[model samples]
Target chain A: MSCFILEQAGIDAPETLADVLAAAETIRDAGIMQHPVAMVSGAGWNLAQEFVNLYLGHGGSFFEPGSAAPAINNDAGLATLEALKALTSFSNPDYLTFDSNSIQALWEAGEVALMLHWGSRGAGILSGDNAAPEIVEATVLAAAPTVEGQSRPATTLWWDGFTIAANTSDADAEASFLAMLNGITPERVAANSELAVWLGEGYQPTPASAGVIASAEGGAAPYPMTPYMGLMHTALGDNLAGFLQGTASAEETLETIEAAYVTAARAQGFLN
Target chain B: MKHRTFFWFILPSLIAMILFIALPVGSVFVQSLHVEHEQVLRTVENCGPFGCTEETVIDRAATEELRAAQPLGRFAGLSNYTDRNHLAFSELGVMWERSDSFADFTRRAMTLPFWRAMAFTLTFTFVVTPLVLLLGLAIALGVNALPRAFRGPTIFVSLLPMIVTPLIGSLILFWMVDSRGVLGAALQTLMNDPNLSLKASPTLTWIMLMVYGVWSSAPFAFIVFYAGLQTVPEEPLEAAMIDGASRWQRIRYVVIPHLMPLAVFITLMQLMDNFRVFEPIVGFQAQANATSLSYNIFNYLRGDAAQFGAAATTSMLTILGVVVLLTPVLMRTWRDFNRKGH
Candidate 1:
């Protein structure tokens, strides 16, 4: 479930994107923290995923049916970028350098009041020794906030599994599959329910899994799965920084992303 | 040495170089001229923990068959070199024709990946190389002037930057320059600006990267100059001293002349090293502000889908760039060698 991990002592948990932004200002003004939000804005798939999550929350589609061409240069994209720029405005000044590790560090250190982080990190922050006790005690996992007038959470579902190599012999493949199955047996899942938001049988919901489950129940979309999506993600990650840096306009940034994606797609033989 | 004996002695290294260097370059050139096969796409129902959705996936079996038919993929000829991701000839032409001023043209051109990397690479190489040489020479002189009792410790301390691995050294600096870090807070206080962030502004980021480059590489130049300083003949120093030359004058007259060749050696190495700056960019997370040809190659080759063709083209172009950059220094050295041979 995509949920906001908040320090309850600072502000009430937010239910919508508007609430999140509002709370961000309140947290800053109250001096609970310098920045209320910490996000991954650096170049990587993580940044692209963050953009896609917001873009999808605004009811945007990546492409039209049967088209490899990107169609994100639209109102949804502009709104997404604007929203991102706004969100980042209240974030740490060095938010551009934030990655998976740094943002978690900020959270554990109780340096930030709120974050949109993976549910998997919940256990480590809550039960792990590193996090400040004040933060751990006050931490509340709520459903992922949504864009204005949107009921669906602005997040995506991810699944981790093992796949056997195609060239492996049938006997070896069978053994590998059985071993994987045994490893994830219902007993194991029940024992490790707090570790992650597991979907299979014998999994019991915990506070750590609340955000992800709430997100799933709220109709969050899965990440886009297509042959050329990786290229588009890379293009977005590389080009979106200019707009965030205040060097380029939103429209110009979108156009550049489109051009960059087309160039990569052509090289990869996804486009003429 | 007899020609036959020379050939036999050098034959082992010749074979090794051909096998290691020449063959790899040849393979990269070939790879750069080709791109992946056009993928066969099909819509399939993907069922997982969530639910079933019709997903667009590359038809793996068909693609494998295509690959089996033609292992090297589709030959792109010179197209890969000329693509927008590479030289971007067409895009450059458009920018050139549309822009009113040189600065406008340069600004538009910097938006392209190749040119952007080139700009930073060239700037870093030019800025860091000279700075390293000067700093290195200064440090060498300063250390050399120290008393024998302190010389060993001073030399060791000066060599500390070079001893630390480049990535770790840069990472340590990266943390220190964070907005909340020691250096960063001091800078903010010094400037009386609470919002000034080294990672925020492109210009500051460039300065930071170049500073790191010079800091990390100066020791190489220093040690070389220091070693060269040891061999400076005492006779010239005495002659210059007897001529009533000042300490500065003595160094300028005798010591510098003795160290000129070492300066050339250091400059050549620094230019080559600085041109391929990669670790600091990664460590500092400065890609949004600065990137180099080596970094671009790394970007292309990493992640879920590796762009082998793009990486290969960048590699070939990087080799070409290194050669072009070293040409003047190499030419001067060749001329000097020829003159001496005569």
Candidate 2:
């Protein structure tokens, strides 16, 4: 929304977080961006919330052994929500009604210009899935989204892996079966790992995956996968709507979230 | 016949209920009291000044063996129920103690997942039920008054909303109300605002969802009331006409009295169904604005461990809540039945 806002006003891409925030004002004033559509809701709202948080540099694992708690209640969190309010203004009016598939459909249908779709899944614009050929061709594998003062984009890392069951009567057999299932064979990766950016040993990235991998190298950061992480994500996802809609202040939202996570972590035995 | 004979006659149904409903409910209650865990066994290697190293490996097999031995893990009792996911009893108490007034308490408590879901569930149930009943009753009365030739087609048209599956129906409506969809575009133009959208605003989304609940469920209500209207006695109509009662009076007193039982039946059924609202939340992706108790359970069930503990807690709470909501209706129906000597 901000990008379009800047373009319409004959301005350039923002150079700093302050500029990006200003661009939000420009768009809000222009009445060109659909702000309500941007606060997409539902089961996957957690992903959307995290996508916003990545901008303020409050993401990654909530449990890093020595860290006291999930880091969603601090300065980074408040900053993220502030930036989030600005960017979410550009989402379509039906954003809260979108799931992964619907969001993808919106992009494919050209109903939306910018969406924080998954890297592997988002690659569809560059390859298949009926994305506008012009947009697809112009698609660039860029670094993760970043905040002005932050060195890295507030992006989350993810992958799929298998854990062989050791309780099986034949551990070795189970391990071998799981290995096969995981596509340890080079041929399997060549044929089927086209959607994956990185694969295990013996598997190679597909042409599409290779490009994304090359671009993301030393760029994206892993999401903090702590025990209390789910609790925190639930807190953020559940409360974000209230804050975004202006029913709750940013401070109230953060405090409520912090209290919820602390209580959950303690109850779930994640905290002493 | 002795009571034993009556019991024997119903024994098969009793057994089936025990197996399907009773057993599952019992198991869920038990599940709510215990957390399931898969043990982790890791090994470490040590390096000494003597330059010798030994290995300790994760005993994955042992961990699985242990898990298999104690599948339910340790029993946590009511902890899961009081845990932050469901009741958040401890959290609520703490927040309450810290807060200065009811407004503050409410502000803080609304943050709890259970309270939030409860608020939506209660609001939706209360809002949708009356609206559905009213729409259904109106349609029934209108259809009943229509000429015989027109009634059939009108009835068919109304039945379409009720007959289509809820998820599919909601999706179809969702697309239409989408900002770019036909209705959405028309609405935007009609309002003379380019940014107007139904699905975007929290209030608008709730209204849309409630409208959907009525649209989809009203047909069932219409069907029931239409069938009930057939039983409205001609004697009362004749008596009312002779007494110079208005057409409105005839319906207000005579037609409604006749449909009371059916109204009770529909209200009880819808209240229960709406209280457990889940599919619309998923189909509409409206969790940002609306969530029901069943959806809360569903969210947990989709988690890594199946979140059996939390899901069961929510399920048990929902079941109890349904029982609470139905108690009066059930008693009223029973009283009516006994009075009717049925």
Candidate 3:
């Protein structure tokens, strides 16, 4: 969808999804040519290419790619893609790459236009030099795109919470835990921004309980809590690395990684 | 008067060692047994506008939650040392069972990374030790053979790398191995391939790491061997040469035996240093899998949540492994030294 928007906007060339994928392969094989794709992890590289394929496959245009979905199907997918492309190409022609640390550095340097980073990244970026105070002025968080014309974007939520050990001998353990939980309120969330910059876009408060921390702000999407997250993360990271390094074709890499992920999930009883 | 002077001569070093070395080791042992936690609290006065309360106190709890999460007894004996808990078969998928016992937890936490690291450390020790020794011996011999005027400069040059901090050497290696750095640029230019990455392939990563390791280490070995070479008896080598022995034969029979003790001493030092190889591995792994045992230990200790107990157990196991592996060499060296003394 983003590719279609890019094509429609004259940001990306028009080509069929298959042709675009083939072209991406050719470019990848040419290996870090005009602009090296700076993928944060192997999973990211796979997802990026997968996204390009999905966009082109949906009858998206090459020229003004971002306009394709909006023109052909009256969808906002092209608009979203255009927004993302505009973000990536804001300061430079280089494709946006997501390395947790490097992206933080870029944000601090005020070099990044549109950074797709964690909530923590936003915080760090804002705190770095305070050069671009406007970035945090009206920060908004949106779910990532799922498919063309899809109204809801699939937002990735990473839940980190404190759990009390059932056998905790410390008499004050529960009290301390409760205090910490109480400290996680919206006011505390705002205060936390002073300590560390979270992108502040999707800042929300949740119950200080040991479950999924859903957003206090309505319309915020939550991540599914699953036991297989660790394995998925590892597999995704490996595949992303392999793709970025050109060790495997993007399609092959994705298929292999996704299959492995499924097998792991099944073994872990995450799937039957 | 002489006895008093001797005591005075060694007293400073003894005091320094007691203060710097013995004290730190003792402190670490003490710290390992006790759990430490830091809690921050804003006093009513400091809390500005918050009413003061005598009961206002914040306490932080630091305990081993993962182990305590089960109905496991505290400090259970060697029951935690079994196969079920062990990570020896982790690659076989035995260790990944969801409902792991406390022993299994300990095994996974302490044993797996420990053994893996020990194996890597051992491999690193064996590979690097001999190379350093042989290279050092060669350089020492070459320098020793040089005209006395050139020997000083040559020895100084050999000592340069050793004199630099290992961390600095590692940092330099990191830059050199970076894809956009000197060695990578040179390789790219030579191969006419811009995409060639020294860190991308595991084999290449290892090769670069080994090269950096050898480069950083060779100087130390050379310095030791050079110093040892200075003690080599000239008469025996001269006699061997006078007896129509070739240069190689003279070196083989006379010089080598003369330098054997020093060579062994240098080898042992190299082995110890290389076994705990951490800095280079850390630098290398920023772009590649050059992780060594020490680096793994460091990572485990500095992980998101510091698993102190596990870290302690791992450290203990690492110490034990090193002792076990090096015992024979240490004994042999001791016995050889005793025999030579006699």
Whole-model Cα lDDT per candidate?
A: 0.86, 0.69, 0.48
User: Chain B in candidate 3 has what TM-score?
Assistant: 0.72
Clashing pairs in 1: A1-A211, A1-A212, A1-A213
Clashes of each: 3, 11, 28
The candidate 1 chain A region of ten consecutive residues with least summed lDDT is A1-10
Off by over 4 Å in 1: A1-11, A166-170, B97-101
DockQ-based class of model 2 = acceptable
DockQ for each model: 0.67, 0.34, 0.05
- What order do candidates take by lDDT, descending? 1, 2, 3
Which candidate do you rate higher for DockQ, 1 or 3?
1
Candidate 1, residues B17-38: lDDT per residue as tens digits?
9999999999999999999888
The CAPRI-style docking tier of model 3 reads: incorrect
Q: Give me the TM-scores of chain B across the candidates.
A: 0.98, 0.90, 0.72
CAPRI class assigned to model 1: medium
Compose the digit string of candidate 1's lDDT tens values, residues A68-150. Answer: 88899999999999988998898887887888788888888777776878766778777857876767776777777899888
lDDT per residue for candidate 2 within A1-272, as digits (tens), equals: 22343466555554344554465466556665544122233334454445444633544334433443656566777777776666565666455555666765665554543445456654565575687664455343443446765655555556665556656568787767877776656666666566566445555655445334643463554444334456667656667777766768888888877766665455444454
